[model samples]
Target: MKSNLFISALFALTISLASCNSSNAKPQKKVETEKPDSAATTKIQVALLLDTSNSMDGLIDQAKSRLWNIVNTLTTLKYDGKTPDIEISLYEYGNDGLSEKSNYIRQVTALSQDLDLISEKLFALRTNGGSEYCGAVIQDATKELKWSSENNSMKLIYIAENEGFNQGKINYKEAISDALKNDIYVNTIFCGNKTEGINIFWKDGADRGKGKYFNIDSDRAVQYIATPYDDEIAKCDEKINKTYINYGSKGLEKKRNQAVQDQNAKRVSASNYTDRAVSKSKAVYKNESWDLVDKVKNDANAIAKIQKEELPAELKDKSTAEIQAIVTEKKKERETIQKEISVLAKKRQQYIDTEAKKTKTQDDLGNTINSSIMAFAKVKGYTVEK
Candidate 1:
């Protein structure tokens, strides 16, 4: 009886211990659920390296009028109406060699927050010649703008010049390679009218640059990049966070960007003009000068008629006599007003070149930095995309 009683007590105590152990055991962890963050997904930077040259007037107009569309597209990206962070830049080509101020360049930089300055520069652009596409691309993708490796920002470039883009000193392949090294993507926007070979070359550039290549034959790139009609009021105007519309004219200050080095930016020769006088000065071309040339011809003819006529030798050509008489009168005038005018013309050209240098360089830098800012704004939580 005592043994049976002791066994019963032992069994009860063992069962109680097992029950306590089971109750005290910790439960398994449940898998954590998380909300999808667009910002966390991927950061993006897009540079619109457009051709702001002679044949791109229509293209320029489109970009100017519809910048908002691209902005609107970017606005659509948001977790709860808060946009993603983005950076957008703009560039132009086909204005080099002929004039210092007029050259290919990346105007806007890697940001999109300021649509106003982008609009101003886009509108300010006019057509010229010389397409240095590769040079500008390399400058923007690697040199000037601040790109972060930590954010995984998608650096993209769009080349939109009508001409074949081999003019810039850098090779197309090398430009794309530089871009790729920085993890930036470059997309080529070519018109359908471009040569097959040229188009193929761009395709190669874009592929190597690790970006999409688009061929739009029409002058509708701006419209194509637009958002639907319903989404107009997008980015907020926060000073700390940066919003569109207020990006104001900040893009005008990026003159020293590396991509700008290859551009024929106009420079003011600080040298003072020659205070000394001379009998003969070089003739420069101008519209008013052309008018002067015409007027001078008339004055010369009047002077010839007023002068005593000398009989020409029978063997001498009649045309020769007329030319000689004209030359003599021009020589006489060279010592007076004409000489002074010539000097003034040189001075005028010097001043003009200086201003041109400032304007063109400012314009180029303006476009590059502004475009870069826009690209940045798009990537940095704005729901806008272009």
Candidate 2:
């Protein structure tokens, strides 16, 4: 009875141990969002805000021609195992700056890759009157434009108002509050004035919005491309070049691994089946271990009757060598693509430079006409912080 009790206790202990092991073996959370092909990772949206105040025609020209350069720069950029989500929205605020027009807060275009449309809109715009900067920020821009704060997405508002904020019924303070609420980055590019008060108001708006601020000197600015088309093409090439090198290489590596897996699986299966057949044969006849001899004989016979040639088919896997070759081949392909990207990028930059010259020509013309206006600004002692 004591022996029987010991066996019972041992069996219960064995069951308990098995249950504990099973529970411990379970994984916590299953991982979702498996890594996809290289192309699947890049996505970022950008908004370009233009200052259409009477003084920034040349600046606008630079922006139109250089649209691609900025995006191309981004292609070389890397994030935490992800690509940027790139989109562009064009908005010009000075349309209302120059006028009491209700539609002055203009959305030239929504988030898009069609940069040409933005360039065209920028080219078509004329600098005019009123700038209710705070209202544009607090009301139209922050509250109205399509953006998601929850996605932790890259949201930006590039504001280039030449003058200060004067429009919004809501005060500058309120605009800051709203910008913080939206988690928006408002990069301010001030062209004419570098002094405080006017430009500083825009600067503070940018600061509150958690964005960078830059003051571009008209004379110092260089147009990096000859045309908007060239800019777009170069920018695109830069992206393809950068990503194809990294992502394309990665894709090829995966294929190589797949090939190896295929090769390995075949060999493993071939060995496993061969061993199983041998073991069964020994057990049935050589050892006479099977109590059901006839049944064991039949099973062994059935196993032997199975086609051995089919074992190779079951075991056939794509070899690692084959996969490695594919990787090399893809790397070569990407190198070729990268060279093309470089050429195209160079051509686009040339266009940007050419466009700069043309825009400068326009700037010269405006400078001639706005001489009195320029003199008035100088005379007013109205200087913003440089």
Candidate 3:
């Protein structure tokens, strides 16, 4: 009888141990299941590396004129029916004003969502006499930028130069290979004849990096198509600017910069200015860091948490509820303005598209980048809304 009892006890002990192990494993499994998928929040990162040598002045001008158009194109993309975050980095190489130790390369902006800052830097670029080191600049961009690691994210590097691709100490082959390993495609844009570009290894760089190559007449000016709806869109832009409630330390400065960027776009051309206004109407033109309406949209309780001192002078004396009410009113006004602008923009685009079919215009910096982005985005399972 005692032997039987001892066997039963051993069986009971085994059951207890197994039960403990199962309970211990439950939490770990739960944790793993709850973990977020990094790929679900995909981003589109673009690096613009422009050769700012003396001969490439026209390239810079083209870039300045097309910044808003490129941005408007990017905002149309959706990943899995959701808009992905967009970031752009700028680099100026082959400028004598830049340090030789850095291979005449200056990172104008790190991969960022601040479109105004990108515009500011692009306009500030000035060409100077310097060696064009394509390989070194490519290597720098590949190594230095905080490129997205998600497999679904689109990472692109567009290097525009008129010089030989193999003009630096760093081999273009190795640099492009490293970029590919990081899932970054390096597109080469030669500002000259196609055959000469191919002979100078520009085509080879694109092929090896799994990107497109094109030769553009850099001296040619960007052409614009004016629409009847552009004047209404400009008026909407003015109204939308008034709806932004700037708060925080840099709020006023950023607000001023917004107007400055508007002026910059207008300085480019009436069509370019309309593009910027249309872009501001989209969801991607967020100014959450400074605009109270945007901040409150992301966080319902943000107004309550913000210190009075951080708020604009007009709102400093108001209570949290008052501030919230003001923000809500401004938000509604902005949305109305945005909707009006959106309608006008659609009409404007239709006009441009119809006009475009009538002329076979040569591709410029904006057209090349925009077309390539759509192609790359489709390959990565992103959809474009026409």
- Which candidate number would show the highest TM-score if scored against the true structure? 3
Candidate ranking under lDDT, highest first, comes to 3, 2, 1
TM-score of each: 0.45, 0.48, 0.93
Per-residue lDDT for 172-218 in model 3, tens only? 99999999999999999999999999999999999999999989999
**Steric clash count of candidate 3:** 0
Q: Is candidate 1 or candidate 3 better by lDDT?
A: 3
The best candidate in terms of lDDT: 3
- Among residues 3 or more apart in sequence or in different chains, the pairs in candidate 3 whose N, CA or C atoms overlap within 3 Å are none
Scored by lDDT, model 1 comes in at 0.45
TM-score (C-alpha, index-matched) for candidate 1: 0.45
TM-score of 2: 0.48
Worst 10 residues of 1 by lDDT: 268-277
In angstroms, the error of model 3 at 19 is 7.3
User: What is the alpha-carbon RMSD of candidate 3 to the true structure?
Assistant: 3.2
For residues 1-386, write the lDDT of model 1, one tens digit per residue: 99999999999999999999999989779888875564554445556776756666666655553343344333334523444455567666666533444344645545553333454455556767665556555655567766657443456666665556566566777767777778776666565554563555766666676654545443543212111211211111011011101101222132122112112111111111111011012221111111222234446443233223322232134464564454455445543544444445344435544665554332122233335445444554444321
Off by over 4 Å in 2: 1-42, 96-103, 132-134, 149-152, 197-200, 219-339, 343-386
